[model samples]
Target chain A: MSQIVCDSSSIISLSENCLLNLLPRFKVDFVVPRSVEKELVDKPLRVDEFEFKALRLREAINEGIIQVKDVPGVHKRAEQILAEANSLFTPRIKILHEGEAECMAMLELTDVNTLLVDERTTRLIIEDIIALGNFIQSRASFKLRMDREKAMALQERFSDVTVLRSTELIAVAYEKGLLNNLGDGHLLHASLYALKYSGCAITKGEIKEYLQLLK
Target chain B: MKKEFVEKLKKAFLHGDARGLKEISNESAEQAVLSRDKEMVLISLVSYALYKMLTKPHYHYAPGWSDFVKEVVSHLELCIKDPRAIQEALGKRLIEDIAKMDKLHGRFMGDLIERARVKQASRAYAMGLSLDSAAELTGADRFRLYAYIGRTRIHEEIPARSVRDRYERAKEVLG
Candidate 1:
C-alpha cells in the first residue's frame, strides 16, 4: 500500500475545498506530526470559508475516515539533529531556519520517500551546494570568503522563473465548484503557486499579473 | 481584502469570541461550495489556523507573544464569519474537501518545524492547542509535545550560545 504524510498547508487547502471526502479515493494514509496538529488548531482563520471547512474537516477526522498519526522517535530524532546541526561546522557555514531544521530532522527520521513541501527557502537550502573559495584582496589583506555567487546566480535566473503546473489542482477545483468566476480561478491558481514558490525570488511582474486577475 | 472585514475578523479571534468564531466558521463552509479557487482557499485556511491558535491557551508561553499572537488570531476569526456568509453552511463537507487538498501541503506542513515562523507558531499553537483539539484540527495522532519537538530537531543545539539557551527554555515545556 502507498503511504503519505501530510503537512498543514495541504490539510488546510484540502479542508477548505471540501475535498477531504476524496481521501478515500486515494487510499493513502495521511500522517501529520503532532506539532503540525498543534500548529493548525491554535492558528486563527483569516477566511470565513476556511474556518467552516476546517471545522468540517475536524469533524470528519472525528468520524475517523482520515487517520492522523504522530510518528514515534520524531522528538528524539529532532533532538539529535538539533545537536548535530548546531555542531555542523566551526562557526557554521549556514544557519537553518527552524522549519528547515525540523524538516531535515523529519526527513531523516521518517522513512517516507516523498514530501509535499511548498516553502521556497527550504527547497533552496536543501538543493543548493556552496563552499569556501579562494581569498580575494580588496584594499588591505586577503580574506577567505564563502563564495555562493554561482548558486545565487542560478537561483536568480531559474529558481523563480519556472512554475509548477498541476492539472489536478485546477481540475479538482472546477469539479468541486470552488471556482466561481474566471478571475477567481486565475487569481486562486496564481496565489497557490505564488506562496509555494515565494522564496524563489520570483519576479514582481508575475505576482502583479496574478493580483490583477483576482481583481 | 476589505479593511472592515479584516478588522472584524481580527477582533473576533483576539477576544476568543466563540460566537463570532462559530459564525465565521460556518461562512467558510458555505463559500467553499462555489469558489474553487485555491488561493482564496489558502487565505481562508490561514485565517482559520490563526484563530484556533489564538482562542485557546493550552501550552507554555514566552511572555510577550501571547498577546501579540492572540491579537492576530482575532483578526482571522472575523474573516471566517464575515457578514456575507458566503460558505458558512457547508461545514463538514468543506473540511473534507480541504483534507483532500492537504496532501499537497503535507511536505510543507511536515517540514514546518524547520521553518522559523512555524517553529514559533508551533510553540504558540501548542499553548492554545489541547492535544484532543489539535488532533481534531490537523488529523494528527496523539503524541507528546516533546516527541514532536524531538522530531523537529528543535531539541538539538545551535552554533550560537544565545540561540541554544533560548532553545533550552522552549524544551523545558516538553519536559
Candidate 2:
C-alpha cells in the first residue's frame, strides 16, 4: 500500500479547492504532522479570515479524514540539519518549515515513501538538485558568491526523498473515478487549473500533460 | 492604477484611519477577481488592512503600537511609484525598527512583511490563482498560504460533490 504524509501546503491546496472532504477517496492515507496542524489551525484561527478553514480542519481531524500525529523524535534530530539547509536558501526564497521537516521525518519512521509538499524550495532541494543549484548560482552570481559548497551540502542532506505537489493528488483522484463529478472531462482541466490558481504548484504544462495522459 | 484612489489611500494611511484603511483593503480584495491589483497594489492594500487590524481602537496599546503605525506611515513619503516595493521595504523596515515591547502592542511593525504575505496569500488565492501560482506571487510557502486560504474557504460555498460527477462527464466526452 502506498502511504504519504502531507505538509500544510498540500492540505491548504486541497482545502482551498474544496477537495479536503475527498481525502478518503485517494488510495493513500493523508497524514498531517503536528506542526502543520498548528499552522493550519492554531495560528490562523487568530485572524478573522482564516477562522473558518481552521475550524473545518479541526472537524476533519475529529472525523479522522486528516489524521494529526505527534511528530516523532527523528524530526527533532533532523531539525539542525534542516535549519542549516533552510538557511542556505535566502530569506526571500527559504523553503524550510517545521511542518515540512516533520513530514520528512515521518518518511523515515514509517513506510511513507513520498511527501506531499507544495513549497518549491524543499522540493527542489530534495528532488531537483540541478534546479536548486541553478537557483543558488543565479542568486549567488548576483552577489558574487560561490554557492557550490552550500548547495551541495543541502542536496546531500536531503537528496534522497521524493516530493509530490497537491496537483498530482488531484490528478490521481481524477484518474480514480473520484473527481468525475466535477463535470465531464472538463473538470479535470478545470480542477487542475483551479488547484494551480488556488495554490497547487503544478505548472500549465504539467496540467496539460496530465490531462492528455488521462485521455 | 487609479491615481485618485491611490491619493485617497495615501491620505488614509497618513491619518491612521483604521476604518478607511479597512475600506481600502476591502475594495482591493474585490479586485483580485478582475486581476486588477497588479504588481503589488494588492500587496499594499493588504498591508493597510493588517494595519487596520493591528491598530484597532478597542485594542489597548501594548507599548509600541503608535510607533509602529507612525513608522509605517513615514515610509509613505518615499517611492510610491511601485506600491508593492514600497510596501516590501516598509515591511522590512518595520521588522528592523520595531523596538522591544510587551506582547500587547504586538510586533505591528515587525510583522508587516509577514502580515503582508498573509494578506498577499489571501489576495492571490482570492484572485483565482492556484496555491502554487499564488504562493509564487506572494513568496509565501504553500502551507502558510493554505492556512490563509483555509480561513477564507470557511464562507466560500464550494460544490464538494462535483469532482466525481465531473470526472464521469469528462470520461464520456473523451470516449
Candidate 3:
C-alpha cells in the first residue's frame, strides 16, 4: 500500500473531529514519525484538557490503524531541513518545528511522497514558497526580507512532494462513501467546516467550493 | 528590546497602568512577529494578561491583586536589567504565581493567561506568521488559534490554491 506520512497537525485535526476511523478505511498506510507521535500522544497525555484526545490517538496506535515509525537518521535530516528552511528568510525566525521537520525527513528518507499535514506553512513551503513569502509580507507591517536563492533551492528540493489537509481527506472520504453514515446532505459541508475550525488550513471559500462540487 | 521599552514596561506594571500595558503588549507582539523572538512573544502575552487583570473590575478588587501586581513588577524590573536572563524565569514564575493566586482566591487568573496567549498568538498570525508558527511560538493550542482565526479576515486576505486542483491531487495520491 502507498504510505502517507502524517503530521501532528492533521492527526490532531482528525482526532479532534473523531475522524480516526477514516485512516483504516483508506487503502493506503497512515504512518507517523516518532516525534509526531510524541506531539499526538506522549506529551498531550499528561495534560488534562488533551488527555482524552491523546487517549483516542493512542487507541488508534494500539489498533494498528496509525503506525509510528522511528526513521533512522531522521534527526540529522530534520536539522538540515530546519537550517535550510529557517535560513530562507532574513532575520531567521524558525518557520518549521521538530515534528514538522521530522515528517519531512521521513518523507525524504522513505518512499512516501505525500504528506498529510493540516498546517499552512509546511504546505506553502513545499507547494508555493514565493506565495508563502508574499502572504508573510502582507501580514508584516515592517519590510520583510527573503533570500531568493535559498527559497528556490528549498522549493526545488521538495518539488515532488504532495501536500494534503484533513479537509481534502474528508472530501476524498465523502467521495468514496466513507462518510455516508453521518447523513448524506450536509455531511461533507459539516465535516469540512469541522476540520477548518479544528485547525485544518483551509479557507471558507474552498469549503464552499467543495460543497458545490460534491453536493 | 530597547532599554526605553523595558523601562516603559516596568513603569506600566509598577503603576498598574492597564492602557499602557495594553499598548506595550501590542508593540511587543508586533516586534515578536518581526524578530521571531520567543521572549518578545512571552512579554506580549504577560503584558496582555497584566492589562486584563488591572482592567477587570472583579480582578482589580480581588484581595491578592496588589500582591500579584507587585510580583509581576519585580519580574519586569529584572527584565529591564537582564531580559535574556530573566525572560524565561519571568514566564515560569508568572505562571506559577497565577496558578497559586487562582488556587488561593478561587479565581480564573490562569485561564486569563491562557486567553492572553491565544489572543497574542492570533495577533502573531495576523501579523504574517503562519498559524502553526504563531501557535508554536506562543504555546497556544492550534485548535483554539484556528477557531479564533476563523472569526477574522486573515484567510480571506490570502490567495489560496484552487480547491478542485488540491482535491483532485489528494484523490490521486491516496488512490
The candidate that wins on lDDT is 3
Chain A TM-scores of each predicted structure, in the order given, are 0.49, 0.86, 0.97
Give every prediction's interface RMSD. 21.7, 12.6, 2.2
lDDT of 1 by residue, B1-175 (tens): 3334345556675676746754453343223212323323333444454444344443214344554454344433544556343234112333333333333333334321112223322332222222222233333322222224323422121111222222232222112
lDDT of each: 0.37, 0.57, 0.79
lDDT of 2 by residue, A146-168 (tens): 25577676667555455666766
- CAPRI verdict (incorrect, acceptable, medium, high) for model 1: incorrect
* Tens-digit per-residue lDDT, A135-182, candidate 1: 111111223233355435433432321111121233334334445554
1 against 3, candidate with superior DockQ: 3
**Preferred candidate (DockQ higher): 2 or 3:** 3
Prediction RMSDs, each to the true structure: 20.4, 11.9, 2.6
Misplaced by over 4 Å in model 3 are B14-17, B33-38, B81-85, B103-110, B128-132, B141-153
Model 3 achieves a DockQ score of: 0.54
TM-score of 2: 0.58
Question: Please, what are the lDDT tens digits per residue for candidate 3 over residues B1-175?
Answer: 5445667877887787889999988888888766777777777877787787677677767787788877877766777777675565557887677656656654553376678888988887665565666778788875566667756666666668888998999899877
